[model samples]
Target chain A: MPHATRIAFVGTPNCGKTTIFNTLTGLRQKVGNFPGVTVAPAVGRVTGTNTEAIDLPGIYSFAPKSPDEQLTVGVLSGMEQTIPRPDGIAFIIDGTNIEKGLFLFSYFAELGLPSIVVVTMIDEIKACGSTLDDIELEHILGVPVIPVVGNKGSGIEDVRLKLTDIKEFAVPNKLAEPEADIPARYTSVRNIAANVVASPVRDRRTEFLDKIFLHPIAGPTVFLAVMALFFQSIFTWATPLMDGIDSMFSLAQDGINTVVPDGIARSFLAKGIVAGVGSVLVFLPQILILNVFIVILEDCGYLARAAFLVDRAMGLFGLQGRSFIPLLGSFACAIPGIMSARIIPSEKDRMITMLIAPLMTCSARLPVYALLISAFIAPIYIGGFFSLQAMVLAGLYIAATLVGLLIALLLKKTMFRGAQTPFLIEFPPYRKPSLKNIAVSAWGRSREFLINAGTIILTLSVILWVLAEFPRANIPAEMQPLQAAQTQLEYSFAGRIGHTLQPAFAPIGFDWKMTVGVIGSFAAREVFVAVMGQLYAADVSENDVTLREALGANISLASALAVLAFYVFALQCISTIAVLRRETNSWKWPAFAFVYTFVLAYSASFAAYHITLFLGG
Target chain B: MNINELAVGKNALIERYRSNTVFSERLMELGLTPGTRITLVRRAPFSGPIEIAYGHLRLALRPAEGDGIYILPV
Candidate 1:
């Protein structure tokens, strides 16, 4: 059996490298950490071939400015212990800007690897009235030049065929030297471009569009409005889909209850597995919806401009403008947000961004926030267009942003004091977002969410069930079922622990039941609602009213606000801490992150509880 | 004058690098060598980073970093 031929994809950022990789690999991709570090390298086996493709992080050159970039160079040079040198390289080049691509390509060509050049953005190049002669390019570079419209799957088959014969590929006797001076290398690249690439007239349409999009006042306003619609859609658009999923799970639970007789098995199956996991699973629609908007924003090239727009505000906190992209990504989940921080060139700034990323209101917190807001705040229409609930939701996001900025400022002043890093970022030209790319990204994110539900949340749900179920408490003979259930929960281990922990949480207005939810949610912040559903004996499908009414009857508006505040500041997700530890390569920063966030959560919750009461909530 | 003092939309020729740090080296590798032609595209709103175009590449540069690049107006 022949070993799988390895091919590595290398390119400058935003050059459609990942899109082409996805097109070839489809569902065969596996995202894992490179040997010793937490930086993820996406590896996938090409279909119907013995070739595997590794999508390295998008980088400009081999001179490593950051840790993530170092991994790319290390792997390519076979200097890394775990990563093997590839047999072939798929060097992606942006079609519109051939000069910069050629400048970087010169370094890789000198490595003398069996390589092929895949030029992306051919459509964009044509739209600008330019043409690239791939035959001419191949003649000049001594490699196969395959021009591809990456998002549309054009030229993909040609790339696949070339990879199969990659070992047979010929190389020029004389290749560019890596040690050449910068000016000389650039001049050579320009010379090559001058031969095969026609200089097209610059498009003025982008300039006209940028005038409004990059305007001082209008830009931020448009960004805010875009964000507002994004959040509102998370609430409105996901409702029907969420209901459909809730009903399907409810049906499955009923079917299980009818078939499995009344026993520990039945209880465990229906309550532990279905109810516990199903409650958290219902938020999938919202997560997918949020990810779709983010994908579109990124694909359409608006994200870089957004970074440019907020650079001044971020600079005030001693953060580089590049921090904006990672922080925005945190709204979907902190793990990706933390991972995206790799793009920040400065180690200090990256660490600071990761530390504060959890402060963004992630999709996990949506279930808890929605439940609390619906139960406490009346649904009044604001300005006849926006609901009061939406306004409150937006306000919570704003509050989180303000708090994150404040913490970043404090950290910069006290602990991570340093000179601000440079904000050198590329602004790619706008294009119509490809539906294929959006679907792939959204699908990948949703799959990851479900996998978490299956593994981590599933195990925790069973443990939580056992903690709230066993030791065989005897029920009073005359009590109703709901009363008997409540009595049993109060006698169980988790209930006892909650009772013991109540005093510590009481000043923040958390009752014993709420305390139990808080403790259960340590593994994941979204598990709080599920824990409440189990404890209250409410059917998971009826979480909207059953759990809501139960919570409303027990807690005041002050307590609800405090709970929201706690989630806003608390570092509640275990995965986030684990990733932080891995990314920082030390236990110290993760420990510090957990402690500081815990203190902030407690203090803020205490203050919110008292303030709401004082304000006559 | 340094890059920060260069007016927006004005074309300039890269004179020399004022800093000898690793970052400056990286910038030079990105084709910002001496005598390269560049133009200040626009300064972001509220004193944000300066945007500049060199050849076909566009980059956003903070004022502090921009101060290290000495340029002569075209």
Candidate 2:
């Protein structure tokens, strides 16, 4: 009958706050937006205890620059009516950087919340010949100061036990006020650090690494090379897994056909549900692979350096260096990327980043790109190291980035123009990435993709099947079976809609079938392939020979390129629009995003079709 | 002298902040108040933000904002 005891985890960025939260909560964390805002605050219950921990966004001070920071302050001060006041505070601080940590600690202490300090990165501190005396810190701060290695899970149990007794901890009534004369605040922080930390050595390892990683020229080159390898692996490594999934689904379809009679139910089970969902599900392997890489890069502390390296280039487009992390994250999927935009300190910058994030070639686009490129571009070695197909794949990615940058520039100059805030980012110390964290992250993201498959994609696939299958046209007396099927599709609902829209798409070389594919993909971009497969009566498996041959025989290279160009610009995914609406907290931005992208897709595809035709393709 | 004019590896004492805004207030909250000693850690290439370090904190400030922070050589 008692309300859950709420514990808040607060810290500056890169202080291993989330790592500790994950260690304590394990799989119990629930991600949801704070009341009335799209910034997600993860709340999780401490294992085997009645305490719930709210993981607040990382911030430097109570002064908020963005909606995310404002939410944190709002929740802490009980200003937001929706979030309850916390019963206790579990303040996380980096052990190696005690002064900054102490400053934040002092600031939060002023709120007079019963709090405990968990000094993380104890291993890194020990490696640097520094020692933190938690007992001495406890005496000075009048709260428990527990030294912990968050990533390794060392000393986590102690922190958990301390949380159980947090209600009994005395709240500091006269702690140092951070807003007092700034020098006095610094002096107080220094006095506390001196009392608890002993014989600290400068972190030379970080310096040496930064010298190479932050070097202007070398940094960008290494970044480019890493990206090159990243895209290459997405293509090469995912093929076998994708093919395996394709065969498994096809075999399932075969099993269904033999067991069930040839009826509408059988058709729905095999073609509508199996093939349609399977088509989208096959991209799961590539999405997982990309997420794993991103998680590792983020966990290892390289992503911040990457942001630092590219700040200037991004600055030219009026984007902060902080925008780099979210935009790069969009390459895997825009949902997480848009969620990560909370880290950007400026509101306008975060909005601009989210608007352009979908322009980054997401993994969903990879399936469509690969399909088009393999069907059109020959597999000849371009320069011994690269295949022509690989070049086109890379080119699609580059084109997406260029288009995103240009649009960001235009938005900044017009709709979102304001004073650009200076960039201020913390470069966290490099440490070995925890495999457990990476595994949890990858699994979490993969599960999200599968859930999307089961819900929205499933519903849309069934509807598409009905639209393509029902109201069969009577075969003409002299027509062959193939022509009869085509006629039936032309008369169906989806087919009718496609036919009505075909004239508009005709200049871009799309037939009614391609138009239907485009219409079906409004559910998600990957559905285009499944819809096309159904239209052609070919097995909707990856690399289906019948589908490829049929498509290649009927479609010109110019039309194939037009389709590729269309997807690169089109905001076709309904889920993306939903998230955009939710994140922006209004339909205005999402509507703008959808309309502009649709216009861009149509005009670009039209131009691409004509240009390629003119070039003799 | 302004923060942007400080050479890399040079240390300075923060004197006063020129711009009065929410962002400048945030910079002060991050311990960039007057009399704090700060060093020019590095300048990002292509006239990008300048990295400044003060008492275990490193922050990047664009030239425009950095120009608003007046400092005296330490």
lDDT of candidate 2 over A511-609, digit per residue (tens): 888998897787788888778767765323323455666677778999999999999989888878988988888999989998888888989899999
* Per-model DockQ against the true two-chain complex: 0.70, 0.59
Deviation from truth (RMSD, Å), model 1: 2.0
Q: What is candidate 2's DockQ?
A: 0.59
| Reference-based TM-score of each model | 0.96, 0.94
Question: How much lDDT does candidate 1 score?
Answer: 0.84
Computed on alpha carbons, the lDDT of every model, listed in order, comes to 0.84, 0.82
Query: Candidate 1: where is the Cα deviation over 4 Å?
Result: A172-175, A476-478, A538-545
Winner by lDDT: 1
Q: After superposition, how far is residue A43 of candidate 2 from its true place, in Å?
A: 2.4
Q: Candidate 1: what's its TM-score on chain B?
A: 0.94
In candidate 2, stretches whose alpha carbon ends up further than 4 angstroms from where it belongs are A33-35, A164-170, A177-181, A474-487, A538-546
Q: Give the candidate number with the greatest TM-score.
A: 1
Error of 2 at A252 (Å): 1.5
